[model samples]
Target: MILSIKNKTLAAITLLSVISVSVFADDNQLTAQEKADGWQLLFDGTDMSQWRSFKQPTVNEKWQIEDGAITLTAGGGGDLISKKTYKNFELTLDWKIAEAGNSGILILADEKGKYIYSHAPEIQILDNERHPDNKLDTHLSGSLYDLIASPIASHKKAGQWNSTKIRLENSALTVWQNDVQTAKVTIGSDEWNSLIAKSKFASWPDFAAAKEGHLGLQDHGDKVWFKNIKIKELN
Candidate 1:
């Protein structure tokens, strides 16, 4: 049957609305452009199937999905690591920590030492304004945890979500927190070696030794939430 003019206009409007929603997809869903660039979601907010407890085959009970975020409710959950490992890549995520809480995003993490941090370089996650860790610049949010300090403070306050972007390509590493450039370094370079020589990692012989490994989220005995975790592997 032929449609009336008014019906045709309404149908066109509905089609436009659908297209708009598709263009501006919600969190945890990749847009078409991202998918084309090889971006993959690690946590789409529904489950933790993409991650497991560090060095283990499963996730722990304390890490739960709440309000579409992977939240660490209490102690004993251990660190969570991605099922797949990556080398050169770009990773983005949103996180929020409780008051005085602490956590971290571990890169090139492997089970070569007694603890995950012993082998992995970390981008720290902390409530900078309230945590005791705030006393040191290297311990603040977005820092290369004790090895390098974030040039500026850009993290949102506790309970507020902060966006983080990390890219490691061709031995060069860069990080952005909330759109502000936080850290930049070239792995295994003279500068990087000097930084590690003075930091706590100097005692850990295998720190940052892996060229490819799993992405990790630290437990840190505190409550923290993460979402919109996505990564794009590079050549």
Candidate 2:
């Protein structure tokens, strides 16, 4: 009886190990627990049906779903925006950049604006070690572009996937890179306005004026890959 019990216990452990591996291998998929928590997959590792081009009618051809990621190579497609606008939410995604690549994730971006950067705030993404933009703290990876610098530099090297999370609730914005909190800022506040005044967006009339708008992925003429994009609305 003891021998039989030992064999059964081993089998159960092996089964659990397999299950864990399977769950981790699947990219851009929401698990049962995530679904129950109201998490939504923005990119399902298959298509760009949930996204469209800024000011354009359709998703640009330069943005392609390749190797289970929304990839942009030889960039010229312009920025990509979510079809639905979000007010307050938590977003998570994985991104990898080519050598010296430059890109960014924009929040509260206006689709009708002349440029996403002019109307929204950006979470800078760059090859921190290789890109010249890294010279300034505000332009480094995971920084709140030109407004606030990341408290810590936690970006993985080029060609390696890095996890990023952005949370916006009650006008407070927080950014995380590789599970580390990189920046925190409050929107539409006096401090925010002061930062904007000092930045290049000082003359942009609609800069950071939208309380709710589409999320955007910048196309800076460099190769970049994004995947496992997901979001959960916050009350």
Candidate 3:
């Protein structure tokens, strides 16, 4: 068949768009390049074997795989932690909260503490517009809970998925929510110490002190769904 230049250009653009979408369309699965780059999938939509209840040998029954997402159902499930520990890495995940629900992603979590929040600093997750935690900017979704407020409130509404990416390399922490830079801080620095002193973690001397620890997902007795949980270690 014969085609004009404009028609040929339009066909080429459409072909490229289709190829681009096909390359990155799947959830809970990594592209070839991602696998080559050392990305690990925590939950690949098949099982939660990579995780367990905090201080427990197995995951709670209530934390189930629902529609390929790790769902916290009802209460008493306890916090979920990664079986393997990491030091400095980049973690990314997608989460959705129930109406007025509250949850958090914990980094540097360890079993030595009575509670997960004791040793880990959290990236806040909540239905920002309705949750009571919204009363304080530091507690809003995407914040470094109680320490650094998310510079931009970029969370989607409740029942909708929100993408969060957290990077902690040499204790220089950075967070992004839905592709927008939300928070940044240097952990254990003078500024971080000062912020913690005025926050509720003031009494917890070991807050986020671990050199290496497991990742955690807070139960918070609320319904929250998480998926596409992945991580990549950094040198």
In model 2, how large is the Cα lDDT of residue 78? 92
Candidate 3 per-residue C-alpha lDDT over 1-235 given as tens digits, one digit per residue, 9 for 90 to 100 = 3568889999999999888765784889887777888999999998999999999999999999899999998888999999999999999999999999999999989999899988899999998888887989999999989988886558688999999999999999999999989888898889989999999999987888887899999999999999999899999
Clashes of each: 0, 0, 0
Q: Give one digit per residue, the lDDT tens place, for model 1 in 1-235.
A: 3568889999999999988876765789898878887989998889899999987899999999999999999988999999999999999999999999999999998876778887899999998888888988999999989977776658678999999999999879999999989889999999999998999888888788888988999999999999999999999
The whole-model C-alpha lDDT of candidate 1 against the native structure comes to 0.90
TM-score of 2: 0.92
Candidate 1 residue 106 C-alpha distance from true site, Å: 0.3
Q: If both were scored by lDDT, which would come out higher, candidate 2 or candidate 3?
A: 3
- Please report the TM-score between candidate 3 and the true structure: 0.92
The all-Cα superposition gives candidate 1 an RMSD in Å to the true structure of 3.2
Q: How many clashes (backbone atoms < 3 Å, residues ≥3 apart in a chain or on different chains) does model 1 have?
A: 0
Q: Considering only N, C-alpha and C atoms within 3 Å, which residue pairs clash in candidate 3? A: none
TM-scores of the models, in the order given: 0.91, 0.92, 0.92
**Which has the higher lDDT value, candidate number 1 or candidate number 3?**
3
lDDT of each: 0.90, 0.89, 0.91
Q: Give residue 120's error in model 3 in angstroms.
A: 0.5
Report the Cα RMSD per candidate: 3.2, 2.1, 2.4
